[model samples]
Target: MKKETGLRWLFFFAGLMVLGLGAALTIKGQRFGVGSWDVLHIGLFERLGLSIGLWSIIMGLIVITIASIGLREFPKIGTFINMTFVGIFIDFFNWLISDSNTFSVQLIAFIIGVLLLAMGSGIYISAELGAGPRDSLMLLIVKKTHFSIAAARTIMEVVVAVAGYLLGGPLGIGTIVIAFALGPIIQVTLKYSGKLLEKSVKVESVAHGHG
Candidate 1:
């Protein structure tokens, strides 16, 4: 049991790091475009004079706090970890990886970033630890409104994009891609990863039993 829990924590941390890296890539590829939350992060950073990653942590905590209130449930430890570490990882990676000069390189980075964001989202959430701040709000909407994940995410993206744009964040093709594409990818990743996690758990149980 302890091992299983530890495995989930490992998955959770891995997912947060990947998520931060993906976000960093998209931010560095900002000339090409970025996701809604990233746009807001950039906007906040530009206007408020803090690192983008710091803004990410701040915004995440705010959202998570509100979500917890709305759901009337305390956040899980994993949720807090997701909020904190993802931001740290983002800052660390952003500092480590320099910006892309070429359009082709930027495009490739953006695409890979998007894929990683979606997959990372699934990988962590599937651990049954806790959803990230934004995703927690999304789940709240899902539970209350009976909306599908795609629809809920789309709605949130639109609103967040508008807010970011108003705050002077660049809105471009990348935003469009994220608005439309990310939800489906995340949904698919969740489906597959969930199945995979289940299989792994069962395999672990069997191996331990035999041992």
Candidate 2:
């Protein structure tokens, strides 16, 4: 049991690190636009005196607070962990990479960012610690709309992207592409990652039984 729990923490942190790296890559990759969430981050950064990642943490806290109010319960420790680490990782990676002017390089970076974003989401969420603030809201919206994940995500993305744009965030072609692209990738990774986590747990249980 302790092993299983430890393994979960391992996956959880790995997911967050990958997720943050992906986010940072996207910003440096494309100057034109970013994903819905990044748009919000950039927007907040412009208005406030902070980095994009700091805005991410701030936004996470606000959203989590709202989620707690709606659910009538506090978030799990993993939730807070997710909020803090993902932001830190993003800032670290963002500072690590410089923006590129070449279109091909930009395209490659954006694609990889999207892929890592999905995979990281899958990894963290599979641990079942708790969803991020926006993810929490996504679930709530899904429930309100009769559990239509696709519909709920689309609506939420549109709203967030628009708000970010209004706040002087980057809103461009990449944003449109991200709006259409990320969902299917996240769905696929989430399904497989969950299976992987469960399989690892089963393997651990079997090994423990033998011991």
- State each candidate's clash count: 0, 0
Candidate 2: tens digits of C-alpha lDDT, residues 44-136: 898876899989999899999987887777888889889999999999999888878898888788888878887898889889888888777
User: Candidate 1, residues 1-211: lDDT per residue as tens digits?
Assistant: 8767877887788778888989988887777778999999988888998898999999999999899998999999889889999999999999999887888888888888888988889889989898999999999888889999988998898899889888988788999899888889999988887888778778888888999
Cα lDDT of model 2 overall?
Answer: 0.85
* Model 1 backbone overlap count: 0
Number of the predicted model whose TM-score against the real structure is largest: 1
lDDT of each: 0.88, 0.85
What are the TM-scores, per candidate, against the unseen true structure? 0.97, 0.95
What is the Cα-based lDDT of residue 100 in candidate 2? 86
The list of candidate 1 runs beyond 4 A from truth reads: none
Q: For each candidate in turn, give its C-alpha RMSD to the true structure in angstroms.
A: 1.0, 1.3
Shift of residue 79 alpha carbon in model 1, Å:
0.7
